[model samples]
Target: MDERSQFLADAAAQRKERELNRVQTETTLKLQALARGYLARKKFVSAVRSTTSEKFSAFVDLEKSEKVLLSNDEVLKWSRLFLRILRLPDDNEVLALLVPDTSYFHWTPSRVISDIISTIPQSLMYISGNRVTENSLFLASNEHKPLISGQALNALFSILFKSVKNDENLLPIFISHVLTCPAIVVHLNKANLDNFLNSELFDRCLTYLRSSPELVESIEPQKTINLLGNVIHLGYLDEETVKNRIVDWTWVIGLVMAQCTEFAVRPGEQSSHNHWHPIFGHYRLPIDPKLWKKLGGGSSSEPTHTAELEKDIPPTLAAIVCQLYMTALSTMTNMKNEIIAGICREDRTLRQLWSYLVRWGNQGRYVSSSSTAPSPLNAALSLMSCPQSLHAAPLMLFADAAAIVISILDEEELYERAVPFALEELVHIARFCNYFCFRAVWTGYVDDRSSDHGLFASIHQLCMVLHVRDSRRSFVNDPKFWLAPDVKSSILMGEFEKKTPRGVLLMRRMSHLVSLKERMLLFRKFVSADKNSNESSATLITGLDEAGIDQDGVFKEFLELTIKKVFDPALNLFHSTAAGVLYPSATSSVHEDHLALFQFVGRILAKAVYEGIVVDVQLAPVLLAAVRFFIQILLDFVVCN
Candidate 1:
């Protein structure tokens, strides 16, 4: 019985092996047949090339001789088939026919020919037709899978690279037409894309792009900007490309800043509502597509100038530039010191930065979610009043990136250059701060504060700078604006300029940056006359005990008690770190009047600073750093939570 079983097994194994061999032989034969047919067509085309050229005055006439010339469908089919065959384990027969004896051709057709075929463009057109949505049928199609798979996609990029290499001017066309196509982009796996970006093909494209800004601007610059934005968004840039390849970081920064400022828009060119991208949300510019199209448009009598047209950045492009700038900031964070040194070492970039800030303050307008009540900071800073309210949300994308860059600049740099700029165009920094502060409170949630730390940290930095400077010397002799004399008008008109000390005036202006007008009154307690602040001292009155006048010891005791009560765990106002330093509780917004309490806590800290009292309480390590910008943490934490 064992011997019979062994014989059966041996027979079955031999049968299976023969079937595999037969299949392999058929595949090889099929490949050979395809190669032979392709070779014959190539030879026939070459033989008739001169005859066709002589007979036809135009290429269209030759195209009409369809049988002699490859059709678009045939080109695509043959290209895909050849690519598939090239990736097979044994394609020697196909290689022998296509490659010359002295020449070598690898995976891509670019290796075989100097020109790009119509297949790539045709495939891109087919793919782009579907618009690359989550529900896109093209993404799920099995028939198109081979064309977008690993080897095929690389070949397509290589074809593009070769075409652009043959003619550098073709770079813009490929960027706008080929790379932007959803079909081509959807196939690019991040891992593969990263490798391609590190290649000379990508380097060459970037070199040409950086060589002339006009080259990009002449075409649809937005398309080029979005392409770069997509690359940055993918986080494909490795340390090598970032450190060595990027020639002008300042130019890149300038390009983004240019897109964010305001431009001419006709009065009648209004949209029913402001548009937010369904995908990008509030992290981008709020201008809708209809409005974007109308931006540069004007009446026949009032023709738009080039200077005005330059400022009409498309809404999508504006959003992308914000995202692009933010991503670039994150990628280059490791080189923060280098950025600081660069800005400090050169005044040209510094001056540009200052100018951009001033322009944004003067021209840029944010869409607020609620009433269009002017921000007090706007009046204080002398920013242009924009009465239009077309969007349902506050625009913070530009403000967020600007805050990050400002935070990156060191205190010495800020003191030397930024301080002067801030003083000169008070509206610049005030408008910036107001944009950040006016964002609506994200209430009724337990959340991560990590994403918002950089922005709030920057505000804290600005606060520290203003506070320290004010303590050393007054900002100006006449701090108050004489226009609004009474307290009510001063607060209503956003002047807050009556008897307001410089530090107090700045602080009061910032406090008026709440989203709701009714909420502005909550800060009225802070809006008071410049009293004898030197003689001002706290007296802790204990029930059924003597009132203690705050001498140095009494003040220290009072501060310690106040801080302990404010940060008490049971109160749920603040959370303590491992080292007992206090930070705002992430879930504190669940409590009503949390914002008011935060304002109160801010006053207490300010008083402590005013009295030169160093409290025994420990604060968050970041807040207690060399630069002590600690104002925004409480409000931002509670409201943004």
Candidate 2:
């Protein structure tokens, strides 16, 4: 017996040593990861400050040293470390390193290049002036030019095409960057431009942008507009070659519409007096008489011939402007149908395009005061009537789009129109909360936490709108509506003296109910309910009282349904254990399991009681049943031992 005991003790000690080693190894890895992250961030910040060639060389040396210090496998473990490294000064050498190759263990080349492009500063891409002129619109000043030169850019593009030429995913980021940099476009030699245009790159990029309207917004608005002007100028200068080289004209048309919406100036409104003519005539090309006629200018107007116009603005450029204006008008007329079709066909693009149009229209003079002008709000709201279109849309997308429309209506002071839509959409989202939660957990499309939080926030905002508009009574009459009674009281009693939405209150109520249901289950299986029986019973009654369950049938029904779903199964698990069916051992394993259950139940009950969700007298039976189960488990353990 003594030798047997000694052997068991030796085995236990070996197992404990193994566990300790495992824990130590895990801790070491985590510490190393943290240290690597710190070093990466430090190196990147230092590199960004290195503006001169000598300093940039030093930065490159530091990166090489880091590579030597850490193995490729170690670096791969630090996923976010590479992202920080891309924020370094935008040098071609550094940019080239970011392009994915076989050396990179984890990330693909396309992902690295996309990150590099996205890290380009917004200030670098956008410029501002008191007035919008050709000089202000395009990056004419040396200060506005990115650190990347024309030759370096061409090399980078060549490398990108050669490395990942067929990567459609990387094309949007590439196209957006190219469209935003006027300096790059203007400085590129004809050979490079011809090469890019001739390749399938341009066609693929345009096709991607059209199918994914959201990616269009990713391009800097000002720079893209200027790019449109440049492209049009090029097309006018070499009509036949430009037409053959260009992949699609609709992409060009889309660019024009985006620019017109952003600038909020119609072609005629800005160019009626030929203020843009001087800029175009600078290229010394002959002006087309047909182009002047299209711009609402008479054939007898001054500068009748190309020679009479300013030499600085080319006639070819002027003709391009005229064509762009005509295209903008045609696009504006059809934008409503196009946006609707885009949303229906691709749900992900819904908010991206909608927000760009809505924000531009709101901030600028895009919406005319004339009754004849189309209302973007009316056009967007029409989507709400088509439930089929939104059925498969992500919860976050649907909620955000609805919020934008409501905000626009509120800004326009169209209160009467906002009421029905707000109420209906709020109810629609509430019904889908469970579906969203389920989808987020089981599928990868929706983020588990943010989507639910965002949906609830949207719900609260709409509820507040209805409450303040004195329309809560209508919502209360609807069986589908779900807001706490206390929230209604706060709204009616004017307890919410500020303009706060009752959504916060509603969310709190829901959170409390969920906690109560979870705690009830925990209590039945693990806790010694007799230890705090009186306290638990009192807390349940208080929660029910606060929820106004006595007076509110809907709230009462919700609570009962939740209890049935969560508490009953937990009680069944406890009953089996108490009946000695699941108590296969009276060893430390059984005791440890019971102890863990007790601790879990205790923590939840404490929180529920504190939150006032455990205060209903109707929960007395459930609480007593838990106490009895706890006693039964203790008795079985003692007998088995």
Candidate 3:
């Protein structure tokens, strides 16, 4: 009883202490706010008073006030005062001073407001002049260029870009003010827009972004990207011209892709079970180990600090990155011409984009598996329902951008005009699609899913597109490139992992070792028994005669022999290419039982793949193309219904 009483008392004391700290913190904050407000108001009044020599007491009078007039110098002073005061911390009483209270001053508010708005672009022009003059010192004085000389217009971009690092909403505030100005709307023609884009300030900003990767999402780059987005939105340039300019300015896209690569690649080990989906429970398929290693994934040792760096990325920094990159992609992609071809002409850019896709596509698996992650349902729903929330969490946004570029890369005409994708790149993309699709299926099945179902749809579309294009193009049966055993294996099995029923089979000596027909019949009966059975979660095992247990060697031998015989020219089921790889016979449809024979052989091959057995058989690109068509058809049916 004494121990219980002591425990209750201690808990009560802790709660009282917490309450006291909360009240103290709140009180301190309120005092700080009051002090800041007083200081800002005093500064505004002093600056305003120094601008005029008239009896200001009469100007302050509500009833006895006459019209208060000001000279040009006085109005400029007031404008500068207002702009300076705007830089102070936000306070309602301070902001209220910007509007001339008619009863207090009897002055025209619209005239003053217009003056303040027009002074913004003038300030930017002044800065641009100074920067250009500084740059000209190293060159000939004859090379001097005049600054932007235009009618005064609202250009809050100067204020936005020059804002202190602590000011978070500067761009939004700038947009809000400038968007309401009639001059800005009327000045949306090409020449005026070009001045903004071609300004020395704009050029300097581009240089800064290209050179300083660490600060790519900082004030200057933010201003540059937003400036470009506005110009694009105004439709001042024709689509082709805009696309050409973007191609010339491809480094902006490069910056975005580089940042994405930094954010996506995590250090340390990747678990084999990272793809597990709770909705699908234990039925979720595991990734193939060989394929995982080929992608530069899976377990590895590294300095502990590398993992720490990933966690070090601030939410604010990541949010800025997502916004900037999305804006750039939206602007570039909106153009009618093929921008991706220009952007991905280099291998580095292509790899960066691919890395982005691989990382973000499976982010759901990461989020779901993480203990510190937000609730899967809440996170997924927020991303779908709120654009702002989605912006803050860039996982899906990164995937979507990468998908757009990749879909463009899939266009055959783009390759013909630009550079053909490297062979390994094609293989990697196909492999990733297959694995991504499988994981997507499990996510869709689970109620607490993580990944976007739209990604699955995109992959489905890509598959069909690639298949149709391949059907029209002649197969390049180059034997030298196809000779590497491992490369051929990855190409054939990497694109599609066929689903097969799992069960154990015990075969007598005569049927398993000798006759092809007998082996096929035996395997057919074994697979048929597993159709309605709940044995899919089990590993497939083959048993030989009583003297020898199959462990995996016997099964591998059986698979190799069965596949070789099935694809032989004597069987007339498939034809051999110059590369010595097998392709489905074009006239095989003439045989009544060809389809069934092919299906049976496919099932056996799938089982071999499921068990991680490497058979010597290689499939030609034409056959792989047909496989892609069927897989896409299956996915379309699954996703649609």
TM-score of each: 0.34, 0.24, 0.28
What lDDT is reached at residue 122 by model 2?
20
Tell me the deviation in Å of residue 545 in model 3.
Answer: 44
Give the runs in model 1 whose Cα sits over 4 Å from its true position: 1-67, 70-93, 96-350, 353-468, 477-641
On TM-score, the stronger of 2 and 3 is 3
RMSD of 3: 25.4
Q: Candidate 1 residues 1-641, lDDT tens each?
A: 69999999999999999999999999999999999999999999766655644544343333364535566677778877877767554677654443332122322232223323423443444444224221222233213343334544445454444444445545555554554333344455564465556555455555555676554444332233345454343334444554555443323433432332222122344354523232221212353343134233111011112232124433233333333343343333334445445434543544454454444434435322234434433321221122111110012223332344444444455545653345545344543443433321112111133223333334434534343333233343334321122234345334333433322333333433322343444344333323434335788455543345644665667777987798797789887765566767878888899999988887888787655566666666444532344433322233223
**lDDT for predicted candidate 1 compared with the true structure:** 0.43
Off by over 4 Å in 3: 1-175, 182-348, 355-420, 443-453, 463-641
Ranking by lDDT: 1, 3, 2
lDDT of 3 at 412: 47
Q: What's the count of clashing pairs in each model shown? A: 2, 20, 0
Point to the candidate with the largest TM-score: 1
Please provide, for model 2 over 434-495, each residue's C-alpha lDDT reduced to its tens digit, 9 standing for 90 to 100: 23222222233233233333233443343333332223134335432433322333342242
